[model samples]
Structures are given as C-alpha cells and as structure tokens.
Target: MFMRGKCIGCGCCTSRCNADALLYTGEEMDADKVLDEVFKDILFYRKTGGMTLSGGEPLMQYDFSLKLLKGAKEKGVHTAIETSGYYPGKLYEIAKYTDLWLYDVKIFDESEHIKYTGVSNKLIMENLKYLNATGSEIILRCPIIPGINLTDEHFEKIAELSASVSSVKKVQFMPYHPLGTEKMKSLGREQKYENCEFLSRDAILPYLEKIKDKTDKILEIM
Candidate 1:
C-alpha cells in the first residue's frame, strides 16, 4: 500500500490491480486504515506468504511504516519495501521490521542523479551500504534511461558497485518508459525527459547480460 501526501494522487494503482484489490480511498490513510484494508486478504496471503509496501517513498512516513511492518510480521505475512534510499537513520529502524528491501539506485554519479530525480546520490548510496551492513536481503534496481545512464560507463560502474555488495540478492536493469509523461502534464509540471525514448528489450539484453556476465550474481530485467 502507498501513503497519500507524496502520491500525486495517481490512479495508476487502481488501473493496474486486475484483482480489483486496490481502490482509491481519496483520503490520507492512517496506520489503522492501511491495516484494515490489508487484513482483507489475510487468508490468501497466508497461503502464498506475500505482501509488499511500496510508495513514492515509504520511509517518509516512518512511524506508520514501523507499525505496518510489525503488524504484518505478527500476522505471518512476508514484508517487503520498495524505496529510494534517501531517508536518514530510518533504514536501521525499518530493517528490524522488514523482511526484504527493494532499493532503487537511480544513477551512480551524483550530478546525474540530482538532474533527473531532484536528489543527490550521496544519501542514497550511504543508506544502501548501511542496509547491506545490517545483513538485509537487498535487490538493486537501476532504471536504464537511454541518454542519461545507459552508457557503457554507467553499466560498468553499476557492475563494480554490485560486485562489492555482499548482501545484494539481484541486480535489475529497467528500461526507461514514457509512462509518466501524461501525468506530468496533468499535474502542470514540465516533463523534462518527455522526449526520451525507451530502449527495445533486444537492445537492453546485451548490456544486461554483460553486467551479469561480469559477476556470478543474478541479473534481472524489470
């Protein structure tokens, strides 16, 4: 489930949930509301052992997340978080309650990350290392933007970083897509990367294979 404020109110979740499990509440949700909704599928989740916490950034609501994770653990549901590692010491606190972490590493270079995401990589990288040190199961997610970070240099840098991290379970290379351009227009913000193109799956395969070939770690395309 996603929190409200940073959400831009995107109805993407409702549109994507084919199971009809997701609905727009049209309101800011507290821990109580989130738990009530999740518990609806407890029987099914207990059988499959699946549950995830994703967001614009989950760590933004630290206490709420802590409660959710604790509750999920008590209910025997596997907990996971999808986040861009920008928060301070929250990683350590959340690690205690979380089962797995989906860490998004946008760009290796600081300036490029700032240009694209309006944030620097300093804190993000630091948080990743901290999570690794804490012995958490972490997956590295990198969005392969054609003009931005899809070059050979960036790929090599990512390989090197991933190789050094012992806690990383897999490295995923995701191709850029224009899926958010229209939303930018609706929100009245200029889409700086609108003209950017998505690389074909064929074109991205070799680069991904090369990165995976460099190390024995699992390489995934997402």
Candidate 2:
C-alpha cells in the first residue's frame, strides 16, 4: 500500500481480485485499494489463512502503512509484512498487525550493505532485534548476490545472527538471477551486475559449512 520506487505499476493484482474492491490511482496507488483487493480473496484467506503486504519497501510510506495495517486487522485478516527491516520506527508501528514478518537480511557487513543497497545496516540490525523482542514470527530471507557477500565469512556472520535471534523460525537463501535484466533495459537503466554468475551448489556449500551448526536452524536454498 505504501507505494514507492519504480514498480511496473501494473493493475494485474487489482484485476485478479474477485472482491471488486481494487482501484487504481495511476502512478501512486492507495492503501485502501490494496486492502480491498487483498480482502477479495477472503475465501482463500479462510483456506490458506492470511494476506501478505509487501512492496518496494512498505516502510517508505510510514503513515499509510500504519493505517493500512490497522484497517486489515480490524477486518479480521491475518497479516504479514515482507520488508528489508531497514526502518525501525515504522516497523514498530506496524508490528501489531503483523502475524508473520518476512525479513530480508541482505548483507553481513555494514559497508557492503551500503555499497549494493545504498543504505547502511545499522537501522536494519536494530529493527531485526526489535522485531525479535516484539514477539513477531520471523522468517529471515537472504538474497545470495553472486559477487557480493558470498564469502564464507559473510555466511558465518549470518549464521551467528540467526542463532542469536530466538524469533527466527527459518533462514532462506536466494541465489541471484537474470530475471530483472530486461526490466532494467526497458526502464532505460543500466545493469549494475551483468558479469556476476548465479551461485552454484559448490560455491554455496563452503559458505554454508561456516554457519551450519550455529543452531539447529532450518537452512534452505531457493
């Protein structure tokens, strides 16, 4: 609902909603519209059990996120938020509506985190700890960018962090892909990581070894 960044802004999601509750606001959509569309699959909600709120970063638009989440809860919709855990204050406000928190732990080192994501990990780390303390169910998601933070040391750090957090129910590793390459060209933007290869099992196993026994944790490669 808190729309920011260069999304395709396609109304595909709105059209798929059977509830007839979705509306478009052009370049910027509304939280109300998102809630409406999501609730359309109330029957599916009854079956699968919840709705997810995710975007470029829901925390980017704080006020709308709070209102959107509160509205969803009032309607008895089980809620989850997928975020990078980069904004603590906003994350705290939305924690109440969140039944599950899908958090992306992108990088281990602060400097490298900034280099690729153009942001520091200080706030992200703070927010992760806060969410863990707030009793939110957490799934730690990691995008294993090929040339960035793909070392044994980085995985060790990640394992330590995962073991330290009592709320972390799982750790997911996602390898880089060229899925967004054409999108960059279509959008008139240059690809920053054209030379990087997708991570291989051989390349990843060593890193995983460094963190394997930190906890009896669920380690998945996707």
Candidate No. with top lDDT = 1
Return the lDDT, model 2, position 212: 83
Error of 1 at 69 (Å): 0.7
lDDT of 1 by residue, 3-95 (tens): 444777677879899998867766787887888888898888876565688888889988888899988888888888999988976566779
Q: Which ten residues in a row have the lowest lDDT in candidate 2?
A: 1-10
Q: Model 1, residue 16: displacement in angstroms?
A: 27
Question: Lowest lDDT 10-mer window, candidate 1?
Answer: 1-10
RMSD of 1: 6.6
CA RMSD for every model? Answer: 6.6, 6.9
Q: Model 2 lDDT vs. the true structure?
A: 0.80
What TM-score should be assigned to candidate 2?
0.80
Q: How many residue pairs clash in all the candidates, one count each?
A: 0, 0
